[model samples]
Target: MTVSVLICDDSNIARKQLKKALPEQWKESALLVNNGEEALEALQMGNFDLLFLDLTMPVMDGFQVLAAIKEQGIQVKTIVVSADLQIEARNKVAADGAIDFIRKPVSASALLDVLNTHGLL
Candidate 1:
């Protein structure tokens, strides 16, 4: 099965970096969005296997997105990608149903690690 992924971040550079770091097979199926609001819209329209989300963003943040996903019962698995490395933020995302969290600046290995741990790679 082709695993579709949605990458949501405010920084264009960050989005590009994440997309580039994805496995070659997954890159073809990856979708990029600028923020959580856009991520939600995309989620509503398509079924994505994974979500690479940024914590701080304009319009809507990753925390809000995670809460919305849980409240609305969205099925995609989420891995938060954030510059914030605080324990509180990590715990919040974890509590909100994110499978994993990656601290920024993200590396190819980090992406691979999260994917592998979650059996998405």
Candidate 2:
């Protein structure tokens, strides 16, 4: 089965790094967005299977995106990839339905482990 993927971050560098960290097959195909609003828009139309999101952004933030996903019952699996490592942020994302929270500058090994742990790969 094809696993559609989305990566959302305000920084161009972050987006490129995330794209690289994704499973090789998905790296070139994953959709990249600059913020939460764009992510949601793409998700609604793309029927994406996975989302790698950022917490701090100039446009809509990841928390708002997560809330909207829960409110609208969006079916995508979200994994928050951010520099926000506060315990509160972690707990909040979990309660909001994110399968996992990955710290920023995400390594390929960590991303792989999380995806593997959840059987996304």
Candidate 3:
């Protein structure tokens, strides 16, 4: 089955880069959103299997999105990708239900590791 994926980030370049980096099959049906609100809306409207979330955003940050997901019991597995490389941030997101936390300027190796660990690749 094709895993439904959502990419939520404030940076257009980051979105484009991630889109480009994704395997063709995965990219074929992926959804991209600019911020957490849109991500939540998409989740409500779509059956996404995975979420790539950025922590910092203008309207509804990723932390809020995570909280909403937990409260609403959204089924998608989330992986936080942000420049916030703080250990506290990682611990908080993990405790909040993120399957994994990835730092920003995501390298192909790191992304591949996440995909592999989650059996998404």
lDDT of 2 by residue, 26-113 (tens): 8767899999999989977778899999999977999999999999899999999999999999999999999999999999999999
Candidate 1 lDDT score relative to the true structure: 0.93
TM-score quality measure for candidate 2: 0.96
Q: Per-residue alpha-carbon lDDT of model 3 for 83-104, expressed as tens digits?
A: 9999999999999999998877
- The true-versus-predicted C-alpha distance at residue 68 of model 1, in Å, is 0.6
In candidate 3 the C-alpha lDDT for residue 72 amounts to 98
- Against the reference, the lDDT scores of all candidates come to 0.93, 0.91, 0.91
Cα TM-score of candidate 3: 0.95
In model 3, which residue pairs have backbone atoms overlapping below 3 Å? none
Which digits, one per residue and each the tens of the lDDT, describe model 1 over residues 55-84? 999999999999999999999999999999
Clashes of 1: 0
